[model samples]
Target chain A: MLFKNLFHHFGRYVIMLGSAFSKPERASMYYKETMRQMNDIGIGSLFIVCLIAIFIGAVTAVQFSYQLDGTLVPVYYIGYVVRDMTIIELAPTFTCLVLAGKVGSNIAAEIGGMRQKEHIDAMEIMGVNTAAYLIMPKVIAALIVIPMLVAVGAFISIIGGYLASVPTGVMADADYIKGLRSFFDPFNVTMMFIKALVFSFILTTVPAYQGYHVRGGSIELGQASTNAVVFSDILILVADYLLAVVLTS
Target chain B: MIRTEDIFKSFDETEVLKGITTEFYKGKTNLIIGRSGAGKTVLLKLLVGLLEPTSGKVWYDDTDFFALDRKQMRNIRMEVGMLFQASALFDSMTVEENIRFPLDMFSTLTLKEKRQQVDKCLERVNLEGANANFPSEISGGMQKRVGIARAIVLDPKYLFCDEPNSGLDPKTSIVIDELIRDITIEKNITTIINTHDMNSVMEIGDNIVLLYQGKLAWRGTNEDVLESDNATLQDFIFASPFLQRLRDAALKRG
Candidate 1:
């Protein structure tokens, strides 16, 4: 019975979305909503992203430079390692993990609170499409801004890594740039984009489903928020590993 | 008119609404009076298709509600207005925007036309010039009035209110009740209210249905209720000190 109800709501949501997507006006509203959601996710999340990226970059460069020990593994290769790791894994996938914890929980909580408070019902009573009016924007925003944030993360980390690698003195500035440029792979960039796209969809859909299905009052709303973040974050990590295995294999 | 036939709803093991049936009249204030756990709110939700009944049917003017498609259900909801116990006004929006929400959603009315309707509804609720105030900016009674204005702005054919007078002084409660009753009469809408407040039962209860433990125990008009021989209803009515004296005097004469 639970499965049946879940499937029914999923089916209804799909059909409603199919119709909305076909309508230009509705689609326009979706674009606007997405932009609004993106601003909320990206702009509000800047501080955390920058903080994480700088530390991860600096730590990675310092560790690699120290391990190299003036030998075959040159200190300048820190930039290459940082670039590869950031573009391939950290920027798109790990950053999304942070966002899922921050933004995903917030979206779920706000929507769940609205549901508990009957504001969502009131919107339905007033003839607003709850999914289109609420969920679409967040999905759109995440898709658009998450990729850009990934790029920004990549840039910040590489710079932090360069600074961290400076004291090692195993390789000169010219050698570091060459190794960094040499390590750049188009396949890794595509991988980053794919990861970003998948993360955005997962974060938006899971949290939205959780929020929409929320029952009970304010207390339940808080539970929904916590559940959305925990569940989505776990799924994202699992998906990241599975995708990594599939691509690597 | 709104009608429920053999509607049954259960939350897992506990049955909240057993085979219950009742009709709410058009252009009259119909009150569903019950104790706290009597499933009044559940019944209200079921009637409006918010919560699907476990068994039986709910009809809005002879049309079985659950039988309709999503589009049709949405269409039906547009004609139905509900006032929640908390007034349920959007905390984010001001009174004007809240009232204009329905118009923004359903109608293609110009901004001017929407504003005009908002002004008229606010004035009708005697809440004129409070349009710019947020829900938190106003008193609880004012919030209820804003809720009523939002409900009626769409010119709904049916109005449902769940404990509309739940948290207010007696004087303010009466004012809200009279406003709801006046709006029902003016629009000729089928108005159903779920409340245990005895004052509401007396103020605007042209028709009353007494729900006892998820079952329709007694149903009658205010006059009929005053003269009822039902012990359950007598106990409920006499729970109020003033009504107890009135019931005792009337019983002595009988």
Candidate 2:
């Protein structure tokens, strides 16, 4: 039944896509929605993503250092620890977890409210494609904003790890920087970007699709919002595992 | 100006519009009247192409609405207006923005021209001074007026209103009904309104289509409706004891 509904909805969007190419106003609305979503979803949540990154980086650095043997796993390699941990896993996947919590629920709740209020129907009646007008802008904005958030988070996490290593007498600043410079891999950085891009798509489109399909009243809208976040979060985790295994293997 | 042929729409096994066929003429207030779940709203949606009929065709003049391409259909839709049940004003937009939306979509008017059109619509709906106010800042009646302004902003040839007076008080409902009727006649626009209010049916039902159980049970003018002897429509009409008493008294006088 869900698949059937999905097909029906997809066909509706195909019509929207065809119409969008010919209609400048539709395209303008898409840009407007993108700008609105970028402000609403991305900028508003930046502080929280940054805070989480800094704290998590500091804690992970402290924990990794405690387990290291001074002779073999030298304290100078703490910079390598921060870089690898951030670029490999923490930045792309976990930051999305945060966005899935904040942004995913918000998109769902908003679209659900519009649906309940019959705005979508009104749009249809007025020759507006609701998905093209409402959903695509958010998708484009999310695609742009999420990668930026990942980059910011990665930078902040490294700074946090540097702060954690500051009081440690064993790790010299010069040695840490040297380690960071020496171990840097273009492949690792590339992989991190690929992961961030994929994560952004999953974090954005899935929640939006769920939110777009929401129906009935306020109770159902609340349920749809919760469902969008939970399902997107789970998908993000599952996607992370698959991408990690596939990329690293 | 609008005609439905054997329209059949259902959700799962439950029929919402069961092979209903009807005609709505131009230059008048054509009201669709029924109780809740009488397929009044469903029929309105179908008429406006918000939902495709399961097994029927809707014609706007000579063009089969379902057979038209997106561009052509959109061209047709541009000439049409709808006032939704919930008002459906954009929460993020001010009254002026909402009124300007349709014009912005379909017109090549410059920004100043758009503003002029917006101001004109706002004035028509008696909402001239509330241009900057958000939907949340307005009362239900004001919101409905804004919805009306937005709907008619493009000077549409056709107007579809679903429960225009649904949440308003009796006096407000009359005001809204009168406004719709006045606008319909003034512009000579083909207007179809979905309503359950008997007061509306009596006040401005130039042409009224009565539905029962998703079927077109009766269709006639407002005067013909009170005089209609069709049992189902009569039951629907006289369901209110006050109306029933009025009908009985009229019958006695005759």
Candidates in order have lDDT scores of: 0.84, 0.84
lDDT of 1 by residue, B99-210 (tens): 9878876678888999999999999999999989999999999999999999999999999998998989999999999999999999999999998888888778899999
User: Each prediction's interface RMSD?
Assistant: 2.4, 1.6
Clashes of 1: 2
> Residue by residue across A1-249, what tens digits does model 2's lDDT show?
999976896686466445433434455656776798898767987999899999878877787788785557666677788888898899888899889878888888877788878887777777776666777777778888888888899989988887877766546778667757767877887777888888777776666666677877787888888878887888888988898899889
Every model's DockQ, to 2 decimals? 0.53, 0.65
Give residue A94's lDDT in candidate 2 (0 to 100).
Answer: 87
- Candidate 1 TM-score over all chains jointly: 0.92
Q: Candidate 2 clashing pairs?
A: none
Clashes of 2: 0
TM-score of chain A for the candidates in order shown? 0.86, 0.87
lDDT per residue (tens digit) for residues A1-249 in model 1? 999976897796576456434333245446655777778898998888888888778787777777777678655576788789888888877788988988888888878888888888887766566866877777778888888887788778777777666645655777667768975669888888888888887787678777877998777888888888887898788889987888777
Q: For every candidate, what share of the true interface contacts is present?
A: 0.59, 0.68
> Fraction of native contacts in model 1?
0.59
> What is the C-alpha local distance difference test score of candidate 1?
0.84
Model 2 bad stretches (over 4 Å): A1-26, A168-170
